[model samples]
Target: MGQHEFSEGVEVSHSQYGRGCILDMIASQTGGIDDARVLFYLSGEEVTVPTYSLAPASEVTSVESTRGTLGTTVTIDDGFYTITVEPDGEGTGYNLSLQAGNAILDQAELSSDKLF
Candidate 1:
């Protein structure tokens, strides 16, 4: 519910399901987490579990985040949605896009307001 404390790409462990990666969180009309789609590693099957039923996997050792440099694009594609980040054509900032299926969920230009 509300904004999820956990996000996509987080590895989670369930009491009944063992270890898995969060594929997606289904959002209700009210913008709360209805449930989570988790792909259990042992079964290789996606399971729908309540958001509260999942816990962060403690066995996670390291995490490597990705970022795109100028004139390049970085994309993260989960089965449920895709997020893309690229340098804005104007050179002022980066363009970020979130898309699900063929529908664009949101797009924005990201930049810092501080002058260095």
Candidate 2:
């Protein structure tokens, strides 16, 4: 749960590619490394990069936080999705709601034990 992990339609700058918008963010498995395969609009090629390497673009809107709790809303990439974290009785329990413009596409209830 780092800041700006990756999201669609977010503007960003690359070390080599200069400037681009993130078209997609897909999980990649190489050498057992959980990396993010990002597609940049400028290069038009999907490349894997560490989440820490990306620089946020000034134009695209994003929400990032080091601290979050119930009723907290985490928005990413100009409203591509809104993730809500709900409170639960168990200290480790987590209930998430994923929304797509007033339409909830998915919801899940889990505990810290379920998530590594």
Candidate 3:
């Protein structure tokens, strides 16, 4: 059995877009591709992006965090959601916005070994 490590509300950064936060992660066992659904709020607007497009912030700058101060940005896939990171002086309370996207109707579909 393979141990899968997944996370929610993770920090991320993007190329075309600036910085953002991760709302959720969807992984495919066959391709080993992890898709991180992200939300970014910019100019009073919310946008959603994917994980593959996100780049680490720590790679851009140095910061402190229990998680190694790693950050990433997700590119907007849809125009419904936005991305924003609230930086408290104490470093807490980080919220990211995610626009609605394709829905996962059946849980069984995720477990199926067949890719298509």
User: Estimated TM-score per prediction?
Assistant: 0.46, 0.35, 0.37
Total backbone clashes of candidate 2, pairs 3 or more residues apart or in separate chains:
0
Q: List model 1 lDDT by residue over 8-106, tens digit each.
A: 888887777777888988987887777889998868999999888776775322323465455666776543456888878666778888886589999
How do the residues 1-116 of candidate 3 rate in per-residue lDDT, one tens digit apiece?
Answer: 11233256655556666556666766678765457666654433345554567665444433223332433323333332333333322333343444333432222111122335
- Which wins on lDDT, candidate 2 or candidate 3? 2
Per residue, candidate 2 scores C-alpha lDDT tens digits across 46-95 of 78776566777554356664345453434453434467665454566767
Tell me the lDDT of model 2 at 95: 76
User: Sorted by lDDT, highest first, which candidate order results?
Assistant: 1, 2, 3
Error of 2 at 10 (Å): 8.0
Rate residue 105 of model 1 by lDDT: 96
Instruction: Give per-residue lDDT, candidate 3, residue 74.
Output: 31
- Relative to the unseen true structure, what is the C-alpha lDDT of residue 91 in candidate 3, on a scale of 0 to 100? 39
TM accuracy, model 2:
0.35
Q: Which residue segments of model 2 deviate by more than 4 Å?
A: 1-58, 64-77, 112-116
Write the number of the candidate with greater lDDT, choosing between 1 and 2.
Answer: 1
Clash counts per candidate, in order, are: 0, 0, 18
Regions of candidate 3 where Cα sits further than 4 Å from its true position: 1-6, 29-31, 43-50, 62-116
In model 3, the Cα lDDT at residue 40 comes to 59
Question: Which is the winner by TM-score between candidate 1 and candidate 3?
Answer: 1
